[model samples]
Target: MPKCMIDGKEVEFTAGENLVKVAKRAGVEIPVFCYHPGLSVVAQCRMCYVEVEKMPKLQTACSTMATEGMVVKTNSENVKKGRAGTMEFLLLNHPLDCPICDKAGECDLQDNSYGYGSAYMRGSEERRTYVDVNMGPVIQKNMNRCIHCTRCIRFGDEIAGIHEMVAIKRGNDIDITTIDGKTLQTEYAGNYSDICPTGSLTLKDFRFKKRAWMLKKTTTVCEGCSKGCNMEIQHEGDVIYRCVPLENLDVNRYWMCDEGRFNYQHTQDPTRIIEPKVKAEGGWKTISWEDGILGIKEEIDGQKPTFLVGSDLTQEELTHIKEYIALQHPGATIQHFGTPGLTSTQQDGALDQILRMKSKTSNLNGAEKLGIAPLMNDTIKADTVVVMSAGRAKLPKINAKRVIAVGVYLEGDASQFDMILPGLAFSEKDGTIVNHQGIEQKLKRAVLPRGKCKSLSEVLMLLTNKKARVGANP
Candidate 1:
C-alpha cells in the first residue's frame, strides 16, 4: 500500500492519485472550483493550494500527484494566504446577490468565500456585469457571476464529446459563450449547470422556483434510459422542483442526460389518468376504485389473456405481475414491451458513445434476465390484452377486442382501452431495476401516488378468487 502525508497525517492512497483526492481521504479540505474528477484537470482557478515540505512554492492540489512519502501542508499559514488571495480575485467580479440567486445555499463560491476568504473590502472599482445569453432550454446563464473556471468547457469536450462552450477573451475580460449564440445541441446538455462551480450556470427548469435549501432531497435512480443514472429528487412538500445527477462511478458517473433530468414532470402532469376509469360511448368515465377493480375482472375473466408488461417496470413490480398472472390466470402469457424497435438486450446498445442508450427503458436487461420474451405482433392469440407500464414504455399494437390498461397513462393514450386502473409512476414506487450493464439499482419512492393510484401488488390482488380479492367478491 502506498502512502503520503497530508496535513501532518499519514494517509494510504492509490498510486498516481492527485493530492485533492488523497487529502479528502485524510479528512483534509482543499478548496477547488475548476476541478471535476470526471473531466480532465485544467487547474485554472488555482484555488486548491497546498504547501509541499520540500517544494519552494505552493502547488495546486488538483494537479499535483501524491508520491510515496510526500509531505503536504494543506492548513499551513502560507497555504491559507494563497487560497485567500485566490478567493479575493475570483470574488472581485462576482456579484454579491446571494439573496436573489437560486444557487445561494449550495453555491461553492459563497461557501469558499466564507471559509477561506478575507472579509474586508479590498477593491473600489465597479463590479463586472454582462447581459446574460440563453444557453438552451435546460440551462440559464448568468455570466456576470462566472469566475472563468472553464469547467463547462472541459466537460463539453472530455465528457459530453461536444465543444459548444468556449471562452472568448483572456484573463479578466473573458466571456464564456457558445458559437454565435447558437442553442445547445447535445442531449446531455443538462449537465452544464450541474458542473458549474458558480451560479454562472443554473437549470432553466428549476430557476427561481424554489430555494436550494427549502427542498427536501431524496436520492433516487433515473429511468429515462437504460443508463439508470443516479440522481437526487429535490422537492418541497412532495412537489418535485428538479432532478440532479448523483455520482455513481460505474453507472452514469456525474452526468445525466436531459431526458432523465426532466422525466419527473410527466408523473405530475395534470392530464395523466391518475384515477380509475371505465370506457363509455364517447370517452372514458371516471369510476370508483371498487368498480374499476371489478370491471377489469369481468372484462377478461372468460377470454384468453396475454399480459403485456412494460420493460420500464422495476423487477419487484414485474415479479408481482408475473406471479399474479400465473396464479390467477394459470395459462396467461406474459410478454415484455419497451422501446418499439428495441426488444431484447442484444438490440439494446449505446445510442451514442456517451450516456444516451439505445434502449429507452431502464429495465430492458432486467426483463431479459427474467426470461421474458419480447412482444411480437404475430404472437397475438389472446382475445383480451392487459398492458401495464410505468408510463415510459411504448405500448405495442394489439389486435384484441378487449384491452385493459393499467399504470400511468395520458388521457389520449387510454382512449381506446376497455378499462383503466390508475397505478403508481416510477417516482411513486419502491423497487429495483437493472441497467444495460446488468447493474441492479434501487428506485426509491420520492413522492406519494397522486389521486387513486395504487401499487402493482394492490392492483393485482383484486383478481384473486378468495376473500383477499377486493372485499369478498365485488
Candidate 2:
C-alpha cells in the first residue's frame, strides 16, 4: 500500500495503482480521453494532468503511479488551467457540429467543455477537416470529430483481437483510419460507439433517431440468447431508442453482441399478438382473460392435459405456472421448448461460451426453481395440451384431443390447437427475470398490450384455484 495526499486530503491506495484510479476511488474524476480500465495505459490525451509536489511540471495522472508521501493536487488552479488548455487544443480541429451529431447529449467532450474549457475559441485558423470514411455497414465514422484518443483503434486490436483499424501518420498530421479503406468487421465492433468520447463513431442504425436525454433508460438483461448479457434499454413512448451494455463483471462485462443490442425491436413489432384469442368455427376469436382461462380449464377437464413451457418466460412466471398446474393436476406432465439458435460468436472462454448458450432466455432457471418436472420422451400420451410462450423444440410429440397455445407469438407447426391464449411480450409485462448467473433483474411495462393480450401472471391467477396476491415483488 502507498499513502498519498490528493487535494490536501490524505488517502492510501494500492502500491502499483495509477494516480487517476486512486483519485477516482476518492470521489475525484480526472478528465480523460484515451484512458480505459481494460486497455494498456497510453496516457496520450494529457487531459488528466495533475500538479504534484517536487515535480517540475504537471504529470499525466492516468499513467503516473502514486508513491509514499507523494502530494498530488487534482483540483489545483494550475491543473485546472492545464486541463482547459488541453481541451481547447483538442477541440481546435473538431467540427463543433453537436447540433446534428448523435453523440451530442451524452458526449464526454460536451461534458468536459462545460466543466473545464473556455466558452470562446482562441484560434482564427480554418478548422482541419477530413473525409468521413466508410468503416462498415454497422458503424459510421466521422474523422473530423476525432480527438486522436486511439480508444477505437485500441479496442479493435486489444478487446476484439481484430487489427482492422490503426493510427496513420505522425505529429499534427496523425489520424486514425483503416488500411486499404477496409470496413470494421468484428462481432464486438459495436462497443466502439460507447468507447468513443465524441461523435466520431456512431451506430448506423441509431443515427439521428432520438436524443439521449429524451429516452427513458431501463436496466434489464438481454434475452436474445442464453448468455443473458446485462443491458440497458432506452425508449420513449413505446418506441425503443437503443440498447447498450450494462457493465456486470460477473456477467457480460461491458460487452453485448450486436444481435442482442438490436433485437428488442421485435418485442414492439406490429405483427406481435397483443390479446387473448380462442379457436372458434370461423378462426381465432378475441376473448376476455376470464373467458380464455375458463375455456382452457374446460379443455383440461375434458381429457388428459399437457403443458408446454417456453424458455422466454421469466423464472417467476414459470414457477407460478408450474405450481398452478401441479395444484390442479398432481400428476400432469409438462414439456419444455427452446427457441431456435441465432448467429453464434467466434470467440472462446467462459464469458463467450456463456454468451453462446443456445437456450436464449432465463426460463430454464425458472423451471428449475418451480420444481416442475419435465416429461420424458416415453411419457408422450396425452388428450389435452397447454402451450406456454414460444420455442417448442423441447416439447414431445403428442396426440392430444385439445391443444392450448399461450404466447405472444404464433410459432411452429403446433398451432392447430383448440384454445389460443394470447400472452404479452416481455416489454408489455411487469415482472422479474433471473439471468444465467443467478442475478435477478426487473422488466418494466413499456407499453400496453394490444387487443385482448394478457400477461402470463394475469392468466395464471384466473386459472389457478388460489387467489393471486396484488403488488407482489418476485
Candidate 2 lDDT tens digits, 22-132 = 888878888888998767789998889999999989999999998999999998899988999998899888887999999989999999988999998899889877876
Best-matching candidate per lDDT: 1
Which portions of model 1 show Cα errors greater than 4 Å? 378-381, 408-412, 468-474
Worst 10 residues of 2 by lDDT: 340-349
How far residue 445's Cα lies from its native spot in candidate 1, in Å, is 0.3
Against the true structure, candidate 1 reaches a TM-score of 0.96
Candidate 2 stretches with Cα past 4 Å from truth are 279-284, 339-356, 373-382, 390-401, 407-418, 430-434, 438-452, 465-474
Local accuracy of candidate 1 as per-residue lDDT tens digits, 1-474: 889898789999998899999999998878999998998888889899999989999899999998999999998899999999999898889888899988899998999999999997699899978887778788888999899889988888888888889999777788999878887888888889888888888888999999898999889899998989999998887699999999998988799889999999998888888778888888878898778777777777655588889899999888888787777777778899888777788888888888879888999999988888888653454678888888888877677788888664444466547888878878887899999899999999888888778777677776654443443211
For every model shown, the clashing-pair count is: 0, 8
Q: Cα RMSD to native, each candidate?
A: 2.2, 4.3
How many clashing pairs in candidate 2?
8
